[model samples]
Structures are given as C-alpha cells and as structure tokens.
Target: MTDENTTVPARPRGGLLRYVVAATLARTADGGAVVAIVLLVTASGDPGWLAGALGACITAPHLLGPFVARSLDTTRDGRRVIALASVVHGATLAAAVLLYPSTHAIVPAALLIASGLLGPLLTGGISSRLPAIAGPSRTSQRRAQGWDVATYGVGGTVGPTIVAAVSAWASPHTSALVLTLGTFIAAGFVMLLPYSPPASDARDVPRPARTLVVMFSSGPLRRTLYLTMIVAFSVAALPIAAVASTDQLGTDDAAAGVLTAAYGLGNLAGSIGVMARPLEGNADQLMTRLATLVATTLLAVALAPSFSLATAAYAAAGIANGYFFAATLAARNEYAPSEIRGQVFVWTGALKITAGSTGTALTGAIVGTAVHLPLVLAIALTTAAALTSASERRFVTRQVRAADHVQPGTVRRD
Candidate 1:
C-alpha cells in the first residue's frame, strides 16, 4: 500500500532555471512585437494610423486567453501545448514582418491579429505552469513566483532594447527577425523542463461558467483582479507620458527612451529584490501599500522639474509597480481553486491587458486633444487604483485564511 503521507515532487528543482529562461525569451519577444510593428510601418511609409491599428489588432486577441488556458489546465502535456503556441506565435509574427512593408496592409494586419490568438499563452499561460514546474510545496511555489517577476522585469527591459539595437544597426525587419529567432529559442528551452505531468481529478473539474463564478465569488481574488486591471490602465500611458516629459525638458522626444529604460531597469531591480527575499504576510495588505507607492511615484514623475528628476521618479514608479505586480500574482495563487487556477490566471491576465490596450487606444484618439492629457490621466488612474486597494476590510486576516481553506493547494504531485 502507498504511504498516505508520502510527498512527491513535481519535477527536478533545477528545471526552475530553464522555466525562467523560457518565459523571459517568450515575454521579451512578445513585448518587442509592438515596437517592431511601429518601426516597420514607419519604414514602409504606410499611413501612421496603421501602426496603432496593427498594435490593437495584436492585442485584441487576449480575449481568447481564458479558453486557451482552460484547455491547458485540463490537459496532461501542457508544456508541449505552450511550446507549440510560442512557435506559432513567432512564425506568424515573422511572416507578417516579411509581408508588410508598405503595401498589402490587409493581409499583414490579419496575420498580426492572428498572432495574438496565442499571445496570452505566451504570457499568463506560461505563468500558470509555474506551480507544477516548481513542485508540490507552497514554499517552493512562492519562491518560483518571485523569480517569475524577475522574468517580467528582464523581458520588459530587454525587448525594446533589442529592437533599438537591431533597428540602429541593421533594419526594422531584421529586428523582427531577431524576435522570431528568440521565440523559437524560448520554445526550445520550454521543452527542456522536466517532462512528467501533474494530475487533477477529472470529476472535480469545474465547468467554465462555474470557473467564472468561482473567480468572482472569492473576495480576495475578486478585489485582486480589479486592482490589476486598474493599475494596468494606468501603466498604458507611460509611452505618451515619456514623450511629453522630454518636451518639457526642451530635449528631443527621443530622449524619452531614457525614462522608459529607467522604469524597466527599476522594475527589474525590484523584482530581483523579491527573488532575494520572497514575499511573506498578507498579499492584499501589501498590494494596498505598493499601489499607494505607485501612485505617489507617478505623481512625482509627472511634476518633476527636469528630465533627470522625471527619470528618477518614473524609475521609482516602476519599482513600486513591480512589487504591486508580484503581490497580484501571489494573490491569484493564494486564492484561486487548484483545478481552475490556470483559467483564473488567464481571465484576469487577459482582462488586465485589455484594460491597458483600451487605455492606450483611447489616449491616442480622445486623449491627445490636451497637452498633458496622458500624464495627467496616468497619475489619476494610479491614484484611483491606490484608493480602490485601500479598504476598511484589509485588516481582516480571517478572509485570507478562509480563502486558503476554500481553495486547495495549487501545486500537485503526479
């Protein structure tokens, strides 16, 4: 007879490094997709609106995230599915780059839009697999989540940096080519993780409708999801704000890249700090504090008197945002039901991204009418997020414990 108390590890611990590398590569490539589209549109001398339209096209497909992740959650060989999605995403992106220079915008635009079908898989789906990849322990899972945040910091910083380097040296098309290669390489790394699959009771699987209900039914999870969306909407204004900030300094708008890079680096540094010391205590309470910090820093950034000060303030915002993000991820892990956790991740991730994309689209259309509109809106939205997170109920530790009981262990042994 099997020992009732026996503990089985999900995979070799060493696979964590491979998982992080794969996630970093996929995210870096995905992050560069917009930059590549913008550059390619400029080179092709297409209507400027085409670039933004294509960007929306690619982003719109995040709506499919839940369905994709639902399939992933129930499947045995999820790694294979993830790898295939990355490959397809990369290939289609490369094809679009080759097809669209100046003419035939329709086909290339369609391809870019199609590339988005698997976009969330490359992002949130990869994240959902972390618990199993890290193995069957809460301690290991939390540590893995910290490293997961590190991937975000690295990817966000490196993606655009790579695009800039290749655009400066070779061509916009070459930069896209480099991205394609990177995704393929990322897929290879993904396949190298330990092969055994985690098991779930099929009879216990929740229906799709039930999954949605489950997500919103939990207090901590519901609030955490809303916080993520609110903050993402705030973050979407960074590019426009960066450009405006440079204008304030009497510097060329290109100098805005410095502000952007500063934020990414600061985010990276904050994530590394989390890796050094994994988060403890209440995630919801921590989120409230971090969201407030994010707001404070964004306000400072907008009001900064000089480019140097603006960069520093923006970097500070990045650090706060990073910590807030880690808290968000942790909350999802902590509160979501084990069987539907992947779908919960995908749904929340998709919606948060949709909020960002919507903010960006609106900023270009309705918001550009005013000079300081983007920065002003960014600061306001971030402040709103802080206020939303601050609650009379935050100190209720009993709710967190209740959630832990309702939601079984996320990590499982095969």
Candidate 2:
C-alpha cells in the first residue's frame, strides 16, 4: 500500500505554455515601447525634457498597480479581463504610433498613459495565475516562478535589441508599430489560455488596509520587500556607471552596450539555472545570501582596474540579481496568504519601480562625479540590506522557537 503522506507528481499542464508565451509578448511590448518612445520623440525634434516626461508618464500609472489589480482579483474571469486589457493597451500604443510625428505632445503622452494604466494586467495578473497553472504542488509553483523570471528577462533583452536594430535599419515609428503588433498578438494568446477563476473563500479575504498590515507584519515578506527595493536602487545606477566606465577606459560608446548585454546574458543564464536546480533551504535565507553576493559583486565593479574586469563584475552582479528575484518570488509564494497574493505581487512591483526610478534620477544628478561613485553607493546600500535580512532572520527564528514552547490552552503573550 502507498504511504498516506506520499504525494504523486502532478502531470504537466499544456495551458502553461500559452500563458508563458502571452506574458512574454506583453512584457516585450512594454519594454520595446520605452526605447521606441525615446527614439520617436528624438526624431520628431522634441527636446530631451519631452522624452523624459513621456517616459515618466508611461511608468507613473504602474504606481497604481495594486488598485488596478483589484479588478482582476474580484473578477469571475481573470483571463477575459487580462485579454481585454491587453487589447486596449495595444490599441493605445497603435494610436500613439499614428500620432507620434505630427501630433502635439499631449496626445501621444495621454495614449501612453492609458496603456500604462493597463500594465498590471500584463504583469501581476499573469504572475498570480502561476500557482493554478502549475498545479497545487510547491515544487511546481517554484519551477513555474523560475520560468516566469526567465521569460521576463528574455523579453526585456529582446525588446530593446529589436528596437535598436529596427531604428538603425528603418525608423523608430516602425519599431513602435511592431511593438504594438506584439501586444495584439499577446492578447490573442491570452484569450486562448485555459484559465478558470479560483474559488472564493470568504475567510481568506481581508480588507485592503488589513491586507497591507498583514503583509508588513510578516518578517519574511517585509524583509523581502526591503531587500528588493535596495537591489532595485542599485540596479538603476548601472546604466550611468556603464557609460562613465566606457569614457574613463577610453572605449567607444559601443562598450556600454556590450557591458549591458553581458549583464542581460548573465541574468538569463541565472534564471534558467534556477529552473534546472531548485533552491534549497529557507527562502528568506537564500534571498539574503544572493543579496550579499550582489553587493560583493558591485563592490568589485567599483574597484575594477579595467573595463574588461568591470564587465565581468557587472555580469556576476546580474547573475546574483536574477537569482535574488527568483528567491523573492518563492518567498512570497510561501509566506503570503492566497487571497492577498495578487495585491502583494502588484505592490512589490510598484515599489521596486518607484525605487529604481528614484535611484536613476538621483544618479543622473551626480553623473559628473567620479565614475565609480554610483557603484560604491550601490555596494553600501546592498550591504545594509543584507545585514537587515540577517537581523530579521534571527528575530523570526527566536519568535518561532518561543511559540513552539507554549502549552496548549494557555495564553502566550509576546
């Protein structure tokens, strides 16, 4: 007879492939739009300030991700909602493309902002469905999350490359149109995916304020968010540092692109590795270790004597960064309750975007300083985050052990 505790492995679901492809296309469109917008604005003879404003407009709606994702949580058919949003977002991009050249700044900017408002459907909505797609097993969920991270990395890398290649050969307008087409294709795939809304549990539901409180109350969740924010800030400093490093080393601007590509390649490799060899030990501990590795790599980048060494260091940092992302996602899956998982995912995305944008802005202000200063600052911030994670781990361990000793039916006050 089979042991009562044994679990049979779940058969892989085919819908998962469709979901991954759809999500990847959405992300690629989103990433390509960034590069396309810059190129289009520049080609239209707009000032740098206008391009920056448009970029901010595109990203600003992501700050409302939690609120926007609430509709997804409440809807009876999440796939339909996601598909509809994707279509609308794509249409907005198409409109922007048509109006980019001769139209006033306000028109395209408004269109871009409309698309941004639908961003949560593409990101958090899709991610929240991973558990359902991969079955109820923890191992399957972890593997699905790893694949999600890898897909996102691939989309980000491919999107910018497509824009660069198209803009060099054709025009930015063509690139924008291509990206808009991608979104439409993604919408079609989303509609084809087999998704059924999860059964509602009244006991699982919590008020938004209560949800926020609970998320922050968990040591693991709180520490994960903090660590993600710190890492995001550091990552934002990379581009500026890349440009500065090329100049300091007497290399052409192409060197900056090469360094960025190296980092992206490393991220892709690390994400794939996570899928192949699952992480062991507590999720929180694994995340802390990865964050520490990122810090060490950043420090090496700061002190590198040559551009070649700096590129390798950045690549190493990227590997750690990718693994940290996978670990953080796993931690959230393990720690967050089912009802509020969507909110948590969207909230984390918003926070990381805000932090990274702020870091980029600040780094821009100090770009004239020493070339390595931003990397040094990133090292300090990441190191602090690692230490914070360690302290939180100890506190959580103590709390768990104390709870274990409490007798049944006795009031155990903290």
Best by lDDT: 2
Each candidate structure's TM-score, on Cα atoms with residue i matched to residue i, is 0.86, 0.91
CA deviation > 4 Å runs, candidate 1: 1-11, 101-103, 135-139, 196-199, 202-210, 247-252, 364-376, 390-414
Give lDDT tens digits, candidate 2, residues 283-304.
8898899999999988877777
- Compared with the true structure, all predictions reach lDDT values of 0.79, 0.80
Once all C-alphas are superposed, what RMSD does model 2 give against the true structure? 3.4
Scored against the true structure, residue 9 in model 2 reaches a CA lDDT of: 54
- Residue 61 in model 2: lDDT: 86
Check candidate 1 and list the clashing pairs.
none
lDDT of 1 at 102: 46
